[model samples]
Target chain A: MLDSFYVAWRYLAFHKARTATLVACVTLLAALPLALQVLLEASERQLRARAEATPLLLGAKGSALDLVMNALYFADAMPAPISMAAQDQVDASALALPIPLYVRFQARGFPIVGTTLDYFDFRGLEIARGRPLAMLGEALVGAEVAARLGLTPGDGLLSSPETVFDLAGVYPLKLRVVGVLAPSRSPDDRAVFVDVKTAWVVEGLVHGHADLGRRADDSVIIEQTEGNTIASAKLAQYTEITEANIASFHFHGDPAGYPLNAVIVVAQDAKSGTLLRGRYLNGESPHQLVLPGAVIDGLLADVFRIKRVLDAVIGVVGLATLLALALVFTLSVRLRQREIHTLFRIGCSRFTIARLLGAEMAIIATASAGLCGAALTAVHASSDELVRRLFFG
Target chain B: MIRIEALEFSYPDASLKLRVKSFQIATGEKLALIGPSGSGKTTLLNLVAGILLPQRGRIQCQDVEVSSLGDRQRRDFRIRSIGFVFQDFQLIEYLHVLDNILHPYRITGALRLTPQVRERARTLAAQMGMGDKLHRPVDRLSHGEQQRVAICRALLPSPALVLADEATGNLDPCNKGLILDLLFASVADQGATLLAVTHDHDLLPRFDRVVDIAEGQSRS
Candidate 1:
């Protein structure tokens, strides 16, 4: 048997290109389904864990899936934003402790989650190093974000502007990284958490500029009306907030109408959760409250249906590839007929010849299996992040 | 020694028939059999080697009757007692020279490739002037060198009978004489009987005896 294997190895090694191509084909065939299974399993686990953690979501009447994805995963497509009044509504109901989330901005590809300290307590996020968000314009980054951006406590992260071509649009805010969250293995691990006021700052809703009252240059102040001074375009506005200018940053209009993508409501108990869901049921207001777990389950069902279609397509392709491989082996056998005849005439039995051929096939399959196994191991190792990227991208 | 009498053979749907009334080769004798195309010289060689079964014949190789043996027994006898050298050399192109020489040992469990057998194979290769070219692939070697490797493979088992079917038919005149010299010397050293089938009458003078075949019968 060892001799047979040696000869088989020699034959395969001699024809390196053919053997390599066959091995690559088989490895891809075997690894595709397995890698997909790993990623899907990870995505399911990730989606389910986060969804089950949050009791309910309050947002504008739209796709519940979109709301849940945006509110939970900080997905790229934002759901229709309800006012801060929605969070107020939930708070006023006395049924839940509403955790207002304004997840609408990004700082260098990481979502800037705007919420109060209650959001941190609800998500169980902890400071791994440095202090928590204590002052305005200060932000705490997730462990992954901190590591990826090479940021320490004092490092600065500039928010990515919404529209680069919009000249009057929001300027990129340079927020101070005050703290780094510990590794949570959740979407929070890659988020940039800040106060809801800072998110409004990134949206240009709130800002600070050089005080016209203290303007040393009178030429920049175009108008001086009662309790109001209209400034010219040359009046320097601060894109970054510091201790010197922090007091100047204030809202211009009613604070109740500030936009929030979704508010995560933590019910005081089961009855309170039910009461909150009932109050917002069927669009009682312009807002709708949803059971996030139910919404995620519905999304997973759709994902599984698509998975079934993908599985069927892969099955057909696998069958076709298998038939093609069979044809290749048959053709190879025919081409080697003369060699087979020579072996027989030299006193080798027909059974031995067949065994040699079988040995060759076994070697090829084993090599492909080894390569497939290695690829699956890598996918399994990185499946958590891969799932996050695929879902949240 | 090989003896054949009243031999008859034919393919199943073919009109070709091969018959050898009587033929004999003594031990250590270099006998050459000459015949025209379709005259059944190759078929006669196959019949003597027990590769083809004769319908009616007494084919004795050494102490055993080659024709009466079972299929498996004939194969064993052929591997153990007889060595074949073909016109085309028949060396596997992928195998290097030493591996081609020892390929017979690898293909069958009957022959154990012991360390001593390996040493003897090396020595045989050295005698064939292929000691330094043992690692060279058979496809890279010249035609004469390939035949030398084939002859080395044939003599590796130290068989009692060496059968050559137009062994030097593919070589140039200079290589033909050189290969013949080496083959005859190796057979003499092994004390093995040589039954070579050839169409080259020029090389017949070197054989101890020559037999001519016409149609299906032998004429010595």
Candidate 2:
């Protein structure tokens, strides 16, 4: 048998071009769907794990998909302002810890999440370089953001466009990169973190009037500076957070009257989460409470149904590839009739002839499988960037 | 000993029928079948080798009936008891010369190529003037050298019978004589029977016996 294998190998190597082309065809056909499956599975696992970690999400009335994407995945647009009254309702509930999240800005295409230090502790993020965001306008960059943007402590970054390109809107705010988070293999690796107050400041919620220069007279004469003029001008334009001025950095209303996008609520356990969900759905409550995991699971269930269909399609494609391989081998044997006859004349039995042919095919298949496996591992190693390009784009 | 009694065969698509009656050779005898093209010389050799069984009669080598054995048993019989040489010198093109010589033993699972067997192959190859061509692929050899290798392969196992189908049909005069002498010498050294099919009248006198197979009949 080993001798037959050697013979088969020699024959294949003698026809290097044909063998290589067949192996490459087989490898590509096997590798593409395998890689796609791995990526989808990895994304699903990441999303579900992140969702399960956060027990509940309290947000203004909107798409639950958007809410989960924002609070859990740090994606999509921030929800409408749930009133401070609504937040107070959830904060008063003894069953949960409300972590207010205000997201509106982007730094070099990464979402800027404004929340308290509890957000870091809850997400298990650690500062890998420099200090955490302790002051307004200070930011903690995710590991990927830091590495990609080459940002370190004290480096400054201006907020990117909130909309596609709202040039007429307020100028981008300059934020100081105060820290970089340690490498965490989660959604935190793609976000920029700051204090919720900084988010409000970035959004122009609370206005500050700095005395640019004091006049020499005892009675001070004040000229509205560029900073105040820009702030107040923006504040007067927005009657509400409409599509026109929702991304506006200036707010004309009282700063205390402003609303947050959503509040991430962590229940003590599964029982408390159920109790909170029931209370919010009682119709007496002003705002709605949702379990991030359950809502995301519902959303993913639809996606998984599509995935099953895709899997069936891939399964059919794989079977077709196998059939094509069998056809190639069968045709190859037919084409090599003279060669087979020659082998038989040289005292090779019919069984040896068949063994030689089988050994040749097995070697090619095994080699192609090995190459496909290595290619998958390389894709897995670089899946982070691939996923970001696919989902976060 | 090899014997074919009242053998009648035909190609699957042809109406031509081949008939051979009372063809026999004693053990260790070298006999050649001489005939023209379409005279059924090659077909008779194939039948005797159990590669193609006679449709109407029996081919007996030593004591085993070639047509009575099943497919697997026939394969074993061919590997253990008989060897073949073709006119085209049908050596496996991808194998080296030495591997081609050992091809018979691979099928039989018989570890026959001991030191003595290797020495015998080397000596026979040297006698046939192919000692330096052992590692060369068969396709690279000249027609005469390939025929010598085929002959060596046929005799490598020291089988009870060796059958050649126009084995030296393409060789030059000098190489042809050398090949015939080496083939008969190797069979004599092994005390094995030889049944050679040929159309060359010049080579007929060297064989122990000569039989003319025409229209499928063997006439001495």
Candidate 3:
């Protein structure tokens, strides 16, 4: 047996290119599916955990998937924004804690999520470096956001302009980074968080005085003027709100009607959850109460349906690879006919020849399985980052 | 010692048949089998080594019935008792010279590979002028060196009988004589009987006896 193995190993080593090609074929057939399964399961676990953690979601009646994506992923395809009065209504229910989420803006490709202070406690977000958001115009950067943008607690982030073509559009807000949150291994890891009102300010729902309350003493300008008290186009809009000018910032409309993309609701108990569901049960209701867990489960069912088809296609490919392997083995045996004859003439039995072939195949298989194991572990370890870059990029 | 009686052999798909009524070689005797290209010189060697089973014959070598043994038993018996050197020097190309010489002991449990056996292989290589090339692959060596390696392997087991099938067929006249000298020297040193099949009559006078297969050395 040892002699056969030595010969087999030497034969494989002798044919370096053929051996490598065969090993690579087997590794791909073995590892690709395993890596895919690991990534998908990790994604499923992350999606399910985030969904289960948030008990309820309130958004304008539309696609529940979009609402889930916006609330959980801070995805760019935002649904229609609903008024803050809906959040007030859910809060007035007294059966759930409603945390408002306004996600209409981004900073350096990272979503700038505007929510209340309770969001940190609700989502179990911990500030890794500095304190949480304590004032308007202050931003809390997630771990990934900080790492990718190299922004520390004392840094500042300017919101991206909604449209470069809209010259008269709302000026981008320059937010002061107050803190950096620890890694959450979720969408939050890549987002920037600020008070909801700051987001409203970014949406042009509020503004400070054009000249910031400066007026010429001799000029007769009394509240009916355009350029009488206005500053230049550059200084016409407040790029940032500080303690000195914060008082002048005022909403253009009723503050209750401020738009929010979605509201995450944590029900007090089962009965309150039922009552909350009942509140939006009517077909005529403009708002929708979504159980994020149920929505995610539905999405996963569809995802798994596609996964099953992919697995079948992979199975066929695996079978074809196996067939090709068999052909290669047969060709190897045929090519070594004279060698086999030599072995036989040297008093090696037919059993020994069979053993030699078996040893060669077993080595290939064991090495491929080992490669698959290593690849699966690597994919599993980096699955969160992989999904984030792949889906969210 | 070797004895054969009533040997009848033929290929499964050919009309040619080989018949021998009786033949014998004494212990430690050197016999040269001379025949035409298609004659039964190599076939007789194969029968004696238990590599081929005769249809109606009993071949006994070293007091064991070679014709009556099973395939597996014949293989074991052949490895333990008979050593064969082929016309083409059937050395595994991938194995180094030392490993090719030790091939017999590696294949059979009947031959245990010991430090002594390895030492003997090295000594044989040294005697055959292959000591410096022991680590070289068989395919890397010259034809003469590969033939020397074959002879080294054949003699390594110290078999009771040594069979050479046109071992010098590919060698030049000078190298051929040198290879025959090596084979005879090894057989004499080990007191092993040698049955060599060759078409060269120039070397016929060296052996103790000449068996002509075309003329029917033994006919009933």
Instruction: Give the candidates in order of lDDT, highest first.
Output: 1, 3, 2
Candidate 3, residues A32-64, lDDT tens digits: the string is: 888988888988888899899988999999999
TM-score of each: 0.97, 0.77, 0.90
Could you give the C-alpha RMSD of every candidate to the true structure, in order shown? 1.6, 6.5, 3.4
Each prediction's total of clashing residue pairs, residues at least 3 apart in sequence or on different chains, is 0, 1, 0
Q: Over the stretch A1-393, how does candidate 2's per-residue lDDT look in tens digits?
A: 777777788778877898998898788888888888888777777778888888788887768777777777777646667755566666687887788887777878888888889889888889999997666667899998998999999888777756657656544667778899999888788888887766766666643432224323423333456555332232333222223333433446665556677888888777887888888886755567887788868867887787889878888887887898789889989988987876565446677788888899889889899999999999898786776566554
DockQ of each: 0.80, 0.34, 0.58
Is 1 or 2 the stronger prediction by DockQ? 1
Error of 3 at B50 (Å): 0.8
Q: After TM-score superposition, what is the CA distance of residue A59 in candidate 2 from its true location, in Å? A: 3.0
C-alpha displacement of A211 in model 1, angstroms? 1.4
DockQ of 1: 0.80
Q: Each prediction's Cα lDDT score?
A: 0.90, 0.77, 0.87
User: In model 3, which regions exceed 4 Å deviation?
Assistant: A147-151, A158-174, A201-232, A236-250, A390-393, B217-220
Residue A200 CA displacement from its true place in model 3, Å: 3.5
Which digits, one per residue and each the tens of the lDDT, describe model 1 over residues A1-393? 988998998999999998998888899889999889988999999999999999888889989988999999988878998899888888898888988889888999999999999988998989999998888899999999999999999999999988899888889999999999999999998899999999999998888888777878889988888887788888887899899899989887888999999999999999988877787776457888898999999989999999999999999999999899889889989999989998988888999999999999999999999999999999999998788778888
TM-score for chain B of all predictions: 0.96, 0.89, 0.96
Candidate 1 lDDT for residue A352: 91
Q: Candidate 2, after superposition: displacement of residue A255 in Å?
A: 3.3
